[model samples]
Target: MAGLRPTRQRIALAELLFSGDHRHVSAEALHGEAGAGGIEVSLATVYNTLHQFRRAGLLREVTVDAARSYFDTDTSDHHHFFVEDEQRVIDIPADSIVIQGLPDAPNGMEVTHVDVVVRVKKV
Candidate 1:
């Protein structure tokens, strides 16, 4: 469980997020879900809680565009398949792709991780 104080709204939101199979969801999508589920939480609260979860290592943030971001329930190493038309994301196993020929880190910086989002469209 996340280490933050468990307020009633946080508890309800967390249940919706963590009580099922791993998924990718944006704040707007989650806000809609919360409303549909009759959880009277505000959109701002959802966004703030999502950022808190991401900082607490309970979720992974995937950025598809400057205007959009999605949070993943699965926190392990992996890539993604972004279906542009549907505005959805699917997980891609980490072993399926390989990265190479990267330049060395600059100064004291180090490369710890790489996130790849392969955008796809239906034929």
Candidate 2:
């Protein structure tokens, strides 16, 4: 949100992403929703905007699956529950996790941060 101006389309997309409730959304899904809502944004624009939001720290990408990327608006230091069956990502509270030492990098690079995503199937 720092360098990005809130354009009409961006604001509308942001409203759809953030204003309602906390949830994960893919660019294609968002584009479909926007189209249903009568917004004239293109799919490529949605994907670009989503990536821009990720770069700006307004959204976090959930990378459980490489083929599709899910966007999250909750930028806090928390984990996620990725339901493989439903293709949903839900926040796991930060306080609920405890961390030990992380595995060392092969290149001796210091670990900047760790994101834990627990994938589960709904029974």
- Top-TM-score candidate index: 1
lDDT of each: 0.94, 0.87
Root-mean-square deviation of every model: 1.1, 2.2
- Candidate 1 segments exceeding 4 Å error: none
TM-score of each: 0.94, 0.85
lDDT of 1 by residue, 1-81 (tens): 568999988888898999999999999988999999999999999999999999999999999999999999999999999
* Candidate 2 lDDT, 79-116, residue by residue in tens: 88988898888899988989887788779677766788
Q: Which pairs clash in the backbone of model 1?
A: none
Off by over 4 Å in 2: 103-110
Task: State the TM-score for model 2.
Answer: 0.85
